[model samples]
Target: MAASSSRSFAEVQRRVSGVHRGTDPEQQLRFYDGWAPEYEQDVTILHYQAPRLAASCLASAIQGPLADALVLDVACGTGLVAQELQAKGFCRFHGLDGSQGMLESARRKGLYQELKQCVLGQEALPASSGFYDAVLIVGALSEGQVPTSVVPELLRVAKPGGFLCLTTRSNRSNLRYKSQMQQLLDDLEQRGLWEKVKVQEVERWERATSEQEAMEGSDYISGVVYLYRKAQTVGF
Candidate 1:
């Protein structure tokens, strides 16, 4: 799909809705693989802000030299999060995504030291324990996307005291999923797996895509960015 300044909301909504209709991980991967080329453009059309917001949340929580931080970007998706982190002075990045096409698109940017394909929830993250200074997964934790169970893998990959940043939509459509995910995060924190650093709720996460939201006169969807630091020692 070619870039079009004149692309309407209907087109963007249609594409987004198509991906949502995917019944299984394979179907979702196929949809994303085919959309990879146009993914950035479509998100740009939606004014997607989770990548930037999550990156910023992680960057602020990082303690040492930004350039030395080995960041693992989960569901990297065309390197949008890496791009935002790079703008903040972080250098090394390792990206992972389920779609080969999406990984290829990220590779073209030459921002990552490594890139791999791993379908979230289905496979273990191909990263060593306690290896990353920071790990982030943006735009992947929402309803019908990655499940909250994957949070453990994210925690496993981060160094003790390293940050883990995640984002999810807080709009009406995602409210139940968000609540469940939030419970998991809170439980982890209670168990000393990690501690909360910041949690920000933004009213304008992206342009509203559903007709129900439009009917409700909402122009943008809400989202939350969650930042947490891995515990240095187990409390359990």
Candidate 2:
């Protein structure tokens, strides 16, 4: 694993654990609620354009109108991608997240058919196994309050032969953190749970506005998108 000046994996792990320690969902909700108004602004200032690119990538990869498919959007922060999906005619959209503020923002968009408030790692999904035809997770694999255990849970809820699409920062940027994501993919493949369908690196570029001259610097970030298809059957 390559070294990163960014937060250490252990440090991120500790933070995630601490966020859930209080056992009060409202505490988590308040944190995201505080972040909602500025969330998009902060990400844009930071050049976090992966979500839009990931949404486009997923929109192109899906076989048909997502309207016909039951879809789940995990950790759907501000419903950016969910809004995109809905715009593309996907009607049965279900969004799940731990932050009440995020869900509030999502609800305001009127994109989701159903919204559930629960932590991704701890909350059990309301659906049965193999219930959804597609699952889209964009920009949720990074540190900062994301649960590492949610990966397997995603696969567990997806139906056989369903599609699971994920996007995250590239391995080149942070190998240790990227390795954690790779491990999730590898484990799913090894268990005959999913088959690799597409993998690509996406680059996003942003230019500073006149008002934000001081923020002009390196204007691009590298990210990766991985799309996998769950197998029709798994052998024990």
Candidate 3:
């Protein structure tokens, strides 16, 4: 599929809405496969900033040398997260996404040292435990995408004192899922798995794409970026 130079908001929203309508991971994968060519363009049209926001938080929270750190980019569609981190001096990255087409697009950027295919929430992350200096998942932790259960898996892959950064929209549609995700994050902190590092909430996450949001007269919706540090000693 060739990329289109011009993409209208209606077309972009329709594509986004189509992906959201997918009922299962396989279906979503198919949607993303077809969407890979224009994914960047569409998100650009939306002024999507989750990748940038999550990368900023991760960069700020990391403790050691950025170049040497092995960062795991989960649900890393088209290498957007890596692009942002690369701009911040982070060099090493391993990416994982379910869509082969999406991975192919990411591969062209030459940002990731490794790229694997895994359906998040349905499959275990294909990486060694306690290896990465930082792990991140952005724009994929909402109601229909990755479940909160995979958060522990993110922590499991990070080295002690490493950081795990995540982002989710806080718009009206995602409030319930966000609440559940936050509860799990809080529970993990209490369980000695990780400690809270930062929670940055932005009012202009992206231009509103849904009709309901437009009807409400809001130009942009809200979102959040969460950063956590893995404990030095984690028990299970």
Scored by TM-score, the top model is: 3
Candidate 3 — what's its lDDT?
A: 0.88
Candidate 1, residue 153: Cα displacement in angstroms equals 0.5
Model 1 residue runs over 4 Å out of place are: 1-6, 214-217
Give residue 98's error in model 2 in angstroms: 0.7
> Mind giving the per-residue lDDT tens digits that candidate 3 earns over 1-236?
12345989999888887755527888888888999999998988898889988888888777668898899999998999999999999999999999999999999999899999999998788987899899999998987888888998999889988899999888777788999999999999988889998999998898888866542557898899999999999853
lDDT against the true structure, each candidate: 0.87, 0.68, 0.88
lDDT string, candidate 2, 1-236, tens digits? 01123444344333333332333445666766777765655554455565566566666777876678888998888888776666666678899887777888788888788888766666776667878888878776654445557777777778888888887664233445668878979987987789998887765522222222222243444568888888898431
Clashing pairs in 1: none
The CA lDDT at 171 in model 3 is 79
Question: Model 3 clash pairs?
Answer: none
RMSD to native, candidate 3: 2.2
**Comparison by lDDT, 1 against 2, better one:** 1
Collision pairs in model 2: 130-159
TM-scores, all models, native as reference: 0.94, 0.76, 0.95
Q: Cα RMSDs of all predictions?
A: 2.3, 8.5, 2.2
lDDT: worst 10-residue window of model 1: 1-10
Which of the two, 1 or 3, has more TM-score? 3
Candidates 2 and 3 compared by lDDT, better number: 3
The deviation in Å at residue 165 for candidate 3 is 0.3
User: Candidate 3 regions off by >4 Å?
Assistant: 1-5, 214-217
Q: Which rank order by TM-score, best down to worst? A: 3, 1, 2
